[model samples]
Target: MSYRIRPAEQGDNEAILTLLQGTPQQGAVTLNFERQPDYFRGARVACEQPDVWVAEARDAPGKVGAVYNVGWRHVWVNGEVRPIRYAHDLRIAPECRNGMILHRLFRHLRKQLAEGEWMQTTVLQDNQASLATVASGRAGLPTYYPAGTIETSMLYTRQRMPRLPADIAIRQSGSADLPDIAALLKAQGQHKQFFPYWDVNRVHGDEYCYGLNASSFLLLRIGGELKGVLGFWDQKPIKQTRVLGYTRGMGMMRHLYNTHSVLRGGMRLPAPGGVLSYLSLHSVIVSNDDPELLRLLLDYAVAFFHGRYDALICGFFQQDRLAKVAERYRRRLLLSEHFLVSYDGDPRGTLDMNRPWYVEVARL
Candidate 1:
């Protein structure tokens, strides 16, 4: 099967979008074929930055058989910030599922990659096709090391006006909180690739982590000492296009589950993937050995966005101690699993499975 592999062009948008709505094996959504917003959107234009590749059928002229994209981010690893690339939207038309078309498509993209740069990608833990494809050595894809799995949890919070003790302080943040917030994020984000550094002025400026204003951020302290921070990220444009079909089974069981939440005065949870609008728990940084602070901080987050969002989405590495603690609070666990694949050996020599990671929805 002869095909043409080249950088994606503006004219390929429609074809790419159509291809994205593929069979369960390759579609972005697990169980449905709903159209997602141009994941690349404005960034696909040449001047804006073209990050996609298209595999066109040589016999059929302009027909696109497959499409793939690369997402890049600057991350702190080991001890310094470095650029890392991640793979996304790797899809092949249903008719081309046989043969070596998938490998051929990935091969083209691999050859064009820069030398010495580490590439990263995440996949749903249950997506057998993607998991097998990445693990298959004969697939003509780059070699990837399975660092570890990360999970996203849908945490719920409610509105509560209570008297606070003199030692406990939870409030909206101000400019004064930036430095500690930045340091805390870095402290928690160490050892993970693509963990963005916080700027004193633009605290969460990285593309995958974008919390800049104080109003969208919350801080917690004890006796004038900063203990924890959380930020609400409004994924506005992408929200409308998210497909809840990814977790249909959980969506069905949501009513029974939310009954207890409503009884407890909490908002009903969005059926998994049912969130069309949400607030991501960004900059989830907390002090060492402070599970109580974590609970207090999360309580504030839940109360802060109550009634304003369909759901509250939070991501954390599997080993995070807070995972165990949070599970005890509300076991809305098993949201989704993600694997961070690092192609080629890590340059920083800091790629250990037990290290701290900044797991969030944007990276997924």
Candidate 2:
């Protein structure tokens, strides 16, 4: 049962992917968040210089028992843009999930982080096992301070796009729009904690914006002035969410729902083992955080992404007023508990509660 933790190399991709496939997030509809083709592709895009770690069985060489990653990027915190780490993709094989393995992994992780370095992570609210583990106060583990809830919605494009006002315009962005896009994102994003600091000029070459380009962004303009921008990213080429299985009752319920959806124009639930086709809505910024502007952008996005994706996914902290906009759509909601982890001190008290919290769902 001995294990050794080390920085993962290119050779560990298959082992890491295997571990991820075996560990599906349990819920009504179980899902396996998999990195296909290569695991590192998705990891590289998470942030700049992503550091991935893997736990291997000493008795069985090359057999990965667990995997984790720390992705560093500049984000707004307490009204300042600074480097922050996002800890994600912490997966352990079912056979090695005993407390000992997790503690060992954290011990090594703790050694790598600086004294006051704080990181953020999210656990699905329904993941009771994970929630309990984080709250367990295990030795050598960082303290996870409760932040808030992230409400992620899978909005179905079931309705037709609404008409826009004569002065309002929605169009795909061009290369010349980078400056204005950057300006709009920064202006609106500053009001939210953890919103990414965009390098719009380099987005096409940035790993964090992998599979995205200027044309992927949809701009909402009023009287020829940019008011909002939403970027659509399709990560399917690198990362994929496959339907693992549904709970007993959920399986039957999904069958009925799919029947009706197929008859209508709604998005039908994917069959088990099938990959979901969806686009993630990123860089979601609007002037004044206006719900009406967001609605207009989403309406145009629906038309822009129609026939190409089954659904569009986005997330907003429950405290965010704009979260109400998604509630009006035909959608399925998933909630995750956000946390700030630190070994030095708690970050919760220092944060301003008035600001909206934003975590790009695509990166997670």
> Per-candidate RMSD vs. true structure?
4.8, 1.7
Query: Which sections of candidate 2 miss by over 4 Å?
Result: 246-256, 263-265
- Residue-level lDDT for 350 in candidate 1: 53
Which portions of model 1 show Cα errors greater than 4 Å? 23-37, 41-50, 58-63, 159-165, 174-180, 187-194, 198-214, 239-277, 335-354
Query: How many clashes (backbone atoms < 3 Å, residues ≥3 apart in a chain or on different chains) does model 2 have?
Result: 0
lDDT of 2 at 72: 90
Candidate 2, residue 200: lDDT: 84
**What's model 1's TM-score?**
0.77
Report lDDT (Cα) of residue 215, candidate 1. Answer: 60
Q: Whole-model lDDT for model 1 versus the true structure?
A: 0.61
- Cα lDDT of model 1 by residue, 277-357, tens digit: 456666666777367777777776666676785457777666766666566444345433443443355543556545566
The candidate that wins on lDDT is 2
- What's the TM-score of every candidate structure? 0.77, 0.95
Backbone atom clashes (below 3 Å) for every candidate: 2, 0
Which pairs of residues have clashing backbones in candidate 2?
none
